[model samples]
Target: MRNNEMHEAGQGVLEDGHGRRFYYLRLSVTDACNFRCDYCLPEGYRARAGEAAPLSVAEAATAMRAFARLGTRKVRLSGGEPSLRADLPDIIAAARNTPGIRRVAVTSNGYKLPKVIDEWRRSGLDQLNISIDSLDAAEFARITGHDCLPRIRTGIDRALELGVQTKVNAVLLSDGATERLQQFLDWLRDTPVTLRFIELMQTGDNRDYFASNHLRGDTIERQLIESGWQLLPRAIDAGPAREYAHPDYRGSIGLITPYSRDFCQSCNRLRVSAQGKLHLCLFADAGLDLREEIRRGDVAALAERIQTLVGGKAASHYLQQGQTGATRNLSVIGG
Candidate 1:
């Protein structure tokens, strides 16, 4: 797109050496969450919660403004649980107000959204990705360590009733993942919410957990196909997910098989930690410290510097079993 057209579409317009434009920014507002998912947060992470404080809403807004200037068209707020932040509406408002940011989305565990769903909708939340790993109440409790399925269902229903575009993200991270996924699909037969199956990432620092529960997303997709589900392609999509829909179903199914398939050549996003560290890839160890930079310096100059460094983004993440991944887990990485 031309400069004017790019600006019109909220396409930050900055390009790398491969001609890829970074239009999406996954910004982690806070690293705190209410639930302790087995695959995400380590067992002892919550017990030792003496880490440094996260950035304030205003501080995050400043960094977002600079990111907008650098060509970020989409901003997705992610965290341990983004709704855990009291100032989430304000943060959404900041992204909605940013000139180059066309979309503002959030990823949450869906336990805290029912109370303030309308408030967040009013604050310009365009879409939501709710994490719902299982349909059975008991298993859900076992995975998330929270017996709050009723509350999560209530929040999801409330979000849908409020006319918010919402989707479900389920991580395939258990021995009976296929069975649970089939049950989850049965539960979604008449619903309109799109469900996306995410592969169990081995990036976290839990070898035992990875060994016991790491399910290959491709195997699951093939299982679904063998069971007569139609796996079709979407003309338009959001990210790495390949969307699919069954002929007789109202809702859709998608596969985010990042490990089985490589979609890095077209990857067009960056990650900003809750503390303002800029990350090029989810599996990379390198990052730019924007937390201190936000304290002082010209936003435009920072934007220019970041734009110049965009070319350094790795072509693909060399991820394997027991490989060194990002320093932090999914929560801290804003996944």
Candidate 2:
């Protein structure tokens, strides 16, 4: 069969009968992080054994091309901080130039974004999602365990000034962070950036932090309503985040309730770690390695392996109360 014919046949269902429509590929370009955020890294976190090496730019692009050939589009490059990757613009350009890729984006902590926002825009980056939990400078520093709020603020403004679509991702912890949420919303009311509130996921080495600072999405929505913020309906894509618009605000709000209400049923994304593991679910313990196969010039075999992996995807991750398993970190999985 022709390449398009093979790709179409691989669509709708995997080889083992799992539907494969709407493939979202998240590629982690690196594992090195600058900030030691309490929610993500805590005070004295150490990398797990054999979790150091990151994929090279060439390998990342090759894997993206292979996946693109298999009907996988909508790629997002993430990392401990994707902006830290030196050749990130090159990687973005490669994915954007790849056939079958409809969307290309990046999620960064926004420290070094100001310097490269124009370069990234020129490289075909469609959207930029920066993690900014608190508007208070001190609170933001405490949350991230770093003094880079000014850089982050500048990066956000620069992205907006360059006419790049931007989204600010804030994780709502139970440390009386609602006020900070309101502060961020108030500041963003005049800007074009969309504010997204993420309910902290209970995975990775930061489980203890999540346990101590867990906040639900319902409480957040109630607080926003009580603050006279009317949530207007807005159309969003098939992502985990539920988006809302406010009448008195120019920007929008997005709630990602992965804990309160998991959207795994409609999950169309697959995460590839920097070390080359294909994770079917975010909370999965193990994954298939496609790096070696792809390097060996076995594109058809790699495609078949991806199909098998997708077919084996669970209806929902088994994240029950008091369950213990070895799950990859969100930073490594590019969430």
Candidate 3:
């Protein structure tokens, strides 16, 4: 039987005190990115002089094994930009080889995708999530501080050709969001990829930027619905996006409205930083150190530690209250 089917047949599951079960794990492979997106890292990524390196191949494997054994079926490798890792393919293979991990995915900026995507796919990458904030080349460059949108587009086409499940993420900004939406929808009329519009969130370092650029996701959601897009039911292991499909378009749209009411009620995923700390919520006040258990190489202890930590997860993130917790910036936790 397929590993996912076996997991569905009643294996152990990870549940928090609020009774939410986790089936997805977003693991950061590194905290460094090449992009200087305005909402994320406006000045680009700088390596900390005395910071410890990210998890080793064996350590990543151990963490994945523990989660898989506890009913986590999907593992997404994230980062400030995950593709920056020279050994990312090795990490992908390790996750794929885990006994109960049914899917291995990666979220990248697509800066190096054109060159290394084939290697990643061969290493068992089942899904790819690329960030393409704007469809206009000039505006894209303005936002991402890179004039390589053409190259990123080429890599996306390559991913499509490889039959990799592809999704594109765009941050909704008050400036020109309407125009960007029109461009995205026009492109989606033919492209079969899923385009996800994420609401601009307020991180500790991005307060002023957030205040200036934040756009409510519901406005876009309402517009799509009015245009006859049908809301689709979420999959058992889906992320927090509410997806919609249009009869005349090949692509689908997903809205990630974190500030919307009850947004956290469907939370089914957890994050672990590249530094080996567990974050119960993206905006939580602190992270629990899991590197110690990983260093001991004790799977049982690691699993127990994870479960104990998860049980203390708060019912919801206080984003509406403008509380951003320990997330000084998105890059720190691979948001």
Candidate 4:
């Protein structure tokens, strides 16, 4: 977009009282996930009775346009599994078609990438983030209740071949972490992908799981530095991960340490739920509904509501206070 248009669109609402400017949006396409991950949905996803259907392709596109007008440069399509949505390619095209949006990304469980990744790339996908919690086949099955590691690996390879920027997200657990980290590092030595180790976060429904599996990423960061892995400078639009690189390794490592002090100070993203609710924070008490404006096809009203709601965003989430407000599980908002 032209500088003048960006100036007008940003009319100062995208920046909060804390002076943070949001340039990224994580938009969930659905809350229903197929994987029965131990940390997220141990019993698997069951649709909530009477819950509104997820935003349609047009609705999602409208919301993206509104955010694009408000200076959002990147949009990441997320879900319990975004690939589960049949119109995912349309959503990807929508983001790519937006004037101000420069990148379109998706986060999925990689269950269907082998079959649909090529189509996704043809539809204008620029980046991919797939969940691969464990490299060990048996452990992967134990964690995700799916014995499809080989298939997922094939999908990752295809993504690499397609020249898409790909990243793997792994939830770091305390159980045998040393061995797990070794496996990850060994794989990264020859794989040209970014492997991110996300510290297990506490949620409303995972107190016991959190207490048992949560691992501090700070220790991992220190280890990386000691082992000659150089920390890379974060870009302005980067996500929460602190990335590192090593000369001997083909791929890189990223540590997402949400519990660290001042973790939210550099926040630069907002979330929109599948039902068209603007979430100020992943752990916010509730979201501001924008379905009405979206349904009316009123971009101005949608943007206005988003700006108004964003102005009241808290300085930081209260996860440090041992409170997970509205998020009952990671799948709820595609965390």
Instruction: Report the Cα lDDT for residue 20, model 3.
Output: 98
Native-to-model Cα distance after best TM-score fit, residue 262 in candidate 4, in Å: 1.0
- Best lDDT among the predictions, by candidate number: 3
Q: What is the C-alpha lDDT profile of model 4 across 1-335, one tens digit per residue?
A: 58755643434338888999999999999999999998999999999999889999999988988887788888999998998888899999988887778889999999999999999999999999999998999999999999999999999999999999999999989998899899999999999999999989898888999998889999888999999999899987789999999999999999998899988998999999999898899999998889999998877778888888888999888788897889989997889
| Candidate 4 Cα errors over 4 Å, as ranges | 1-13
TM-score of each: 0.90, 0.88, 0.97, 0.97
Q: How many Å off is the CA of 109 in candidate 4?
A: 0.5
Model 1, 147-241: lDDT tens digits are 98888888888888888888999988767876887787886688888899988777657667777887888887787788677867543226677
Q: What local lDDT does model 4 show for residue 38?
A: 89
Candidate 3 per-residue lDDT, tens place, 220-319, comes to 9999999999999998788899999999999999999999999999999999999899999999999899999988888768887898899999998999
Per-residue lDDT value at 212 in model 4: 89
At residue 311, give the lDDT of candidate 3.
97
Q: How close is candidate 2 to the true structure, as a TM-score?
A: 0.88
Error of 2 at 191 (Å): 1.2
Q: Between 1 and 3, whose TM-score is larger?
A: 3
- Which pairs clash (backbone N, Cα, C closer than 3 Å) in model 2? none
Candidate 2 structure quality by residue, lDDT tens digits, 91-112: 9998887776777889998888
